[model samples]
Target: MEFLQLKYFQTAARYEHITKAAEELRIAQPSLSKTIARLEEDLGVQLFDRQGRNIQLNACGRAFLEHVNRAFMELDNGIKKVKDLAGMKKVSISIAMTLPKILPKLLSPFLNQYPHVHFRQIMEPPSILKRKLEDGEIDLCISPVPFGSPAIEWKPLFTDDIYLIVPTDHYLAGRKSIHISEIKNESFILMNTGFSIRDLVDKLFNEAGFTPEIIMEVNDPETIIGMIRRGKGVTFISKRDWQYVSHLIPEKIRINDPNWHQMIGLSWSTKKDLSIEAYHFKQYVIEFFEKT
Candidate 1:
């Protein structure tokens, strides 16, 4: 099979629409289709299921797409490595994170050391970040916890306490700390379901034996903090996040539950080739936490 055939098949699999994929690749729809057909024939498996004009990845296609993505990613990494070795290094590291606000502080030391380094940051939920890391779309991810993938290598950073935040005028605001069971009936403005903190909050509520009365689910931490300042609802905040806007929300009550804290860490692909820049950044992160 030709390399172009694999590339065409991957583009089609990504869009799952032959015409749209062709448009994106700047190729004719029929040519793209024939290329994919030839690839399927060579592989002896149907990559997609066609429903008239629409198409979807079949089981085999999904499996094949995984390998194709990694193959392209490795090829890209190889080119970058050669460029770095030739002293034409202009490294760009792609990163996805749940707590993006913390990244500036975390990366400052590394950036100070390597002024030539650049980053592409994607602030996404933990689930999506994990998927991107697994798919080799991003070089690394910073999240509360590691995903259970053999291809992923998780290095523990540091743990932080989770606070039950409320407005100063709220009824529970006077208390030094509160139990998870205490907040069962209160309205909550939490992060949306994809976040690691959201998962933790849901699990805490489940253990407390009642579902929270969620008023709104937000993606941004600043929005959640804003709502809390206006006495809208209560939500959990990591110690790191709370530090940034502590003056805005003074009622940072600790969660009395022992397991209420989160362990944030760096996760990278064990299978993908790590560029020199990514390798240095990973080491810097691990050592930074150690010094702290």
Candidate 2:
């Protein structure tokens, strides 16, 4: 019934452990348990199924938690709106992306125009980025692939062709284009697994019917380019990424496959209300891509 009771119940449901939730809430365990008990009594339904020391949210608990989450989200949105109306708080936007390098290009101009606005950025894989959107933890997500969730809305910003890149002096560098099968035996330097690009390239490899002889698995794109420049190995990179490595001038050959392109886009949860500042940034991102 009380706001504190609902807050305590939300935290308990998240952890499924009274002790852990109480620890996080910085309250005594007994007090937290009593609060939950009172809440259940008022609601006239058992929310959690209890074991000795652990608890699980029952069907009723899960159903109620959905409404509780929406209630908290709306309260947070109301606070943000009031702060915006009063000009009492500096606007901040939280963004998560799969591609870290593109953020500067997207944010620099916008930040220059609105110097007082603050930005919090994070780099996460596509799956985690999707979850962050649904949980309202991030205002927007820039991803190479669509999250494909009914609760999330995605818009394609641009598509870039994927290309095979190798050292200038490599044997196949003279060719303008090549099939993936032709390079099946060649050593590759690839982005590590879990990266969206890595997953895309892996699918291409699978379609080509052979596993690439990977000489290195790297996390940084610049490092992968550095290795390629030294003739260490070859790799696949999107066309837009060429701007970062153009000076090095590694040989970029087109892949003959029809599916060798990636669509990068922005996504946000349909369930959460966007703050005025966050909404502006989202529009800025869309226009930024349009002009490019």
Candidate 3:
């Protein structure tokens, strides 16, 4: 079957509805349907079962999806590799991330070291990033992909020690660390709900046999820090993230436990091509961690 047809199928299966997939692909519904039908014909297999207006993948479709995904992934990798070699050595690193605490501090140094390299950073959650990285849509993801996914190669960057961001005048502001149980009744202004960091927070609270009050939820750590500055609530983030804004910390170390930390890392698609730039960026990141 044609690659475009497989793409159409993927979009359709993703939404589980023809109209939505057509809208996403920006194509006419009838034309999309015909293309899918042609794909099924070419493959000599029924990929989906139509139930009234809704569609569901069949057993064969499920099996073929894996191969189709791999095919496109390899194609994208080949294109990137060719571009890396032909282009003006402007190695473009696609990073889906939360702004790191050390980004600005390290960026000038990084640029000075590799002036030819260019960066395309996108701030997104790990789940979306994991899907894009696996699909070869990005070169390297510099966020926690969560639970060590097997589809991509994972490189551990560092153990991100957790720190609590409390208001400048909070009761815990005078202490170096706060026990997890001490904040049993305290409300938290935290990252979005689906984040791996949030999951880690839950696990920590669970281990302490307490649930945070959870007064507010936010997506960005900077915003979380801002909220804490306004005394809205307290939140936790990694030392790497904290380093980026430690000057504004305002004596706000709300650490409940000193030992708690999260591991952050880099990831790349195992099925894709690794351009020299991507390779160099990965090595630089690893070396940074090692030197620290």
lDDT of 3 by residue, 5-85 (tens): 889998998887999999999999999999999999998989999985589999998898888888889889888766665
Q: Give a tens-digit lDDT track for model 1, residues 1-292.
A: 9999989988888788888999999988889888988999999999899985479999999998999999999999888776774558777889877777778888887887776778999888767777788888899887887898898989878898888888989998878887787778899998899789999878877877798899999888888888888889988889888888888987789877778888988899987887788888888878877887
Query: lDDT tens digits, residues 67-86, model 2?
Result: 99999999998887777745
* Candidate 1 structure lDDT: 0.85
TM-score of 3: 0.66
- Looking at model 3, report the run of 10 residues with the lowest lDDT sum: 250-259
- My TM-score estimates for the predictions, one after another, are 0.70, 0.69, 0.66
The numbered model that scores best in TM-score is 1
Candidate closer to the true structure by lDDT (higher is better), 1 or 2: 2
Off by over 4 Å in 3: 1-89, 254-259
lDDT preference between candidates 1 and 3, better one: 1
What RMSD does each model have against the real structure?
A: 13.9, 12.0, 14.4
* Residue 153 displacement (Å), model 3: 0.9
